[model samples]
Target: MLADTATIVARLTEFLGPDSVVADPVQMGSYLNEPRKRFHEKAAAVALPRSVAEVQALTRFAFEHGVALIPQGGNTGLVGAQVPLRGDEVIVSLARINALREIDAAAGHMTVEAGMILEEAHRIAEAEGAMFPLWIASQGSARIGGVLSSNAGGVNVLAYGNARELCLGVEAVLADGRLYKGLNALKKDNTGYDLKDLLIGAEGTLGIITAATLKIFPLPAVYETAIVNLASPEAALELFYTMRERAGMRLNAFELVPLIGLDMQMRHGMLDKDPTAGPSPWYALIEISQPKGAKGGLLQAGLEAAFEAQLIDNAVVAESLADRTRMWAFREQMSEVQSREGASIKHDVSVPIAAIPRLIAEGSEAAEALVAGIRAVPFGHMGDGNIHFNFSQPVGADGKTFMAGAQPVHDAVYEVVLRLGGSVSAEHGIGQLKTALLKQVKDPVALEMMRAIKQALDPRGILNPGKMLD
Candidate 1:
């Protein structure tokens, strides 16, 4: 039998002090409001667990009482994974558990509590003369647990990989309140199964991540940055190949930005000045890391080669740190600039590197045919083959009406993505937003395997009850 809300709050307050348990709806607003504003379900109460032990205790109580427990971090997830789906569920915010447990610069690893902010982790790594490279726009507010849960990928994915790759191991609270002590700095571990991998990206459906051991790397001495003008996606692809052949793993980022993105930023005054080489149909922001004692200007030489080969129309290499920052700002601000235009339908999808050109061409054409006057804004990590395929509503259209018509546009873009052998979600995982889409697009056998795992691990369905499944 389900406990009354008062009884639940009373018991929680008894276990964890009254300071940690939030019962008032108004006080729970911070935890309830997600980034997208798409999910609007109210949680029964928000519990701020101050330590790993407290997290374990809360999980134990929820497991025994059969109360749904939704694990939340900084509440900055683009998908609704960090928020509640069921109104009756209790949200366990890890914010109070923030702590940097250990840092072993010699071993190239750091142990951080789940609630530690992503930007804080970067600072810790930098202080120790190392780097933790999993970066996202929401790093200021996104926490380590949520970042690992989503397995976030940002601009540096080409060089450093995603959160899963950076994470060495995790300490999670299982469905039964049993602690899984998986954190370690060891580079090699051949266990029976990869449970760490399972929990990292499970989005709290499998377990609650409390702390993790993450890999760190030596900070690069400098970065060679450039923005190259391309005639089309095909030309960008050719240029990407040239850079990959030349720089190999040192090629940190190769981002694609359309002409419209620059126009939007300039029109909205988001940028102080145009950060491009005159006008071009498309542009590719490329960066290469120069390790300590390594030579710089590798990117400039590569661009010179491309120019000589007629692969690129024109290019502007960053002459100073200010120039590099402006170049990156132009790339990162692509998503935010869309809101200035109007209602935008977005899809974070990826295809094979070679197929990215086709994915963009076909997806754009399909979306335009479906919604007349729709502005296609296809851009993102070209090196990793992930494109943030977004569409702004036609000029002078109502945002609500345009958003209401997003279903068909989504189908059209996803169809092309599927045909290109790409993922429906690249960096962003399937939260409540895409659970049905996941069920439809995911293989039946894979779905069955996921269901079996969910059943085996969270048999009571007490952890994140309605997310990533149905």
Candidate 2:
């Protein structure tokens, strides 16, 4: 039998105290409102568990009652994974559990509670002469659990890889309220199947990640940053290959941006001045790390070679900290500036590195063909073959009307991505947003495996019900 909402609230208050259970609707806005503003379902109640035992206890109650439980962290996920799918679900926000368990710079690892902010993780590592390199625009508010749950990839993915690669181990509460004690700093562990990897990107469907052990690296002595002009994606690809061959692992970041992004930032007064070297059809923001006792100016030399080879038009090397900040601000603000314009259709997809040029060219053409006067704004981690392929609707089109026709636009872009052997979601997981797309594009055997895992871990279908799988 289902437990009454009143009874559930009373029991939860008794166990966790009234201060931890938020029953008021107004006070739950922060947990319900995600970054995209796409999902609008209200949770039954917001539960803030301050310790691992509290989280385990809450899960036990939820599992017994057959009430769906949504695990949330920082509420900064671009997809709706950190929010409730069904209105009757309970949201367990991990914000209050923030704490650093241990940090060993010599050992090259750190253990942190899932609720710790991403930026705070960075600050802690920096204080110990180490670096945790997972970076996103929302790092100021995004937590470690959500970052791991989504397996976030940012600019440095070219060098450091995504969250899953950086994470060494994870400690989570299973669906039946049993604790999975898996945290460790060991580099090699072939004892059995990798359960940590499964839960890290599962988006809370299999388990609730309460804490994790993350890998850290020594801090680089300096960063060589530059904005180089490229005629097109093809030219950018050639320049990337040249830099990769020369700088190797030191080549940290390589991002692509279109001319319209600069125009939009200028019109909105988002940038004090143009950060590019000069006008071009596109720009590539490249950076290289200088380790201690290593030589600098590798980026400048690579740019010079590209210029000699006619691969790039021009380049501007950042001379001061302020200039470097301005260059990065231009790249990081791409997603936020889109809302200022009007309704926008976005896709975060990736293809093989060699196919990126064709993917962008063909996808952009198809979108324009579908909607007359539609502006295409394709940009992002060019080095990793992941492009944030977004399109702004035709000037003066109603936001609702434009969004109503999203099916055809999505079909056009995804068809091209599929043909190029790319993923429908490169960084963002299949939250409520892309579940259907995943079903359509994913392999049959892979889908079966995922379903089996879900069933094995959550037999009652209570954890984040109707998410990724459905």
Candidate 3:
């Protein structure tokens, strides 16, 4: 049988003092209230561990008593991975354990505690004349552990790859409180099984990540950014291929935006001014990172070639820092502006780079057929083929009524995604939200392997129980 809330709180308080343990329901609001405000289950307590040793101790007690423990970082996760699944579980927040363990700018690697904020990691790397190039929308609030746990892919994923690729090694506490001291700066070590890769995107079901050694690169000399007007997704695709061919790996971000995004932002006062070159049916926010000591004007040259090929009709290349900032703001605020419009059903899925245009066209048509006047706001990292396909409710429809019909909309979108050989969940890791969907969509053998690995590592099923593999 599981321990009650009082027993859990008293034990946690004994382990980490009264100040670090928050058992009062009213005091635990921040931890309970996730970003989406979707899951409403209350946690028994919130344990803030200050060091690695404290985390191990907490895990030890939870394992012995068969208590569920949820590992949370900044709580900025769109999916409810970092939030409580069961009301009886205790939340372990890593916000206080943030610290830099080691750094070597010349070596191009740094070891940081899991709780370190991603934006702070960027600043630290910048101070050393280098950069940790994983740029995500929630970098300001997302912590290193949570980012790695989710294997987060941000805008710059086209150039820098995701969190799993950026990390060289990680230190974690296993389900039974045994420390897995895997922290290292090795670029290659084919000695044994790739344990680091297994734990990264596991959503904390296997273990609690404590620290990681992350890759860093030399800071870029200049960023060439532009918002190019396109006729449709086809034009944007052609433009993407052209720019990538010209810039190669330097082409970092290629984001797609619809005209509806701009209109909604304008209607809700989200942007200071229009950032695109007038208006068009579609827009592609493309950026190229030029290293120090390299010649500039690659983006401009590529754009001229694209114009010649008739891939883009008009474009606005950012001439100043403010211009670049505003252009990025337009892309970053795509998700936020949807809330102002009304109820929205969102899907973060990815497909092969070649199939993006078809995915958008067919998916939108299918959704429109399902719900008349459902505004399809499909936009995101076009360079990497991960579109945050979302649909806003009809202008005059009731929010609750539209949301009630969300399952059909989701089914329609996922059908198109799967038919085009795409993924159901791209950047957001499966928390409690998509467990059943995972079972249905994932391969049978793959699920078996995952279960075996979970059982081997977390026999007690104490670390982030009822998550990922549910």
Give, for candidate 3, the lowest lDDT window spanning 10 residues: 1-10
- Number of colliding residue pairs in each model: 0, 0, 0
Q: Write down the lDDT that model 2 would get.
A: 0.92
Give the per-residue lDDT digits (tens) of candidate 3, residues 1-470.
45678988888899799999998899999999988788998999999999999999999999888999999999988889988887889999999989999999999999999999999999999999999999888899999999999999999999989989999999999998999999999999999998999989888999999999999999998999999999999999989999999999999999999999999998998889999989799999999999889999999999999989988889999999999999999999999999989999999999999999999999999999999999999999999989999999999999999999999989999999999999999999899899999998999999999999999999988888888888
Candidates in order have lDDT scores of 0.91, 0.92, 0.93
Off by over 4 Å in 1: none
- Give each prediction's root-mean-square deviation over alpha carbons: 1.0, 0.8, 0.8
Cand. 3 Cα-lDDT: 0.93
Q: Can you write out model 2's per-residue Cα lDDT over 1-470, one digit (the tens) per residue?
A: 35576677787888899999997889999999998899999878889999999999999988888878999999888779989887888899899888999999889999999999999999999999999988889999999998999899998899999999999999999999999999999889999999999998899999999999999999999999999999999999999999999899999999999999998888999999999988899999999998889988899889989999999978989999999999999999999888898999999999999999999899999998989888899999999999999998788988888889988999999999999999999998898998988899999999999999999999999889888999
Please give the lDDT score for candidate 1: 0.91
TM-score for candidate 1, please give it.
0.99
Off by over 4 Å in 2: none
True-vs-predicted CA distance for residue 205, candidate 2, Å: 0.3
Error of 2 at 41 (Å): 0.6
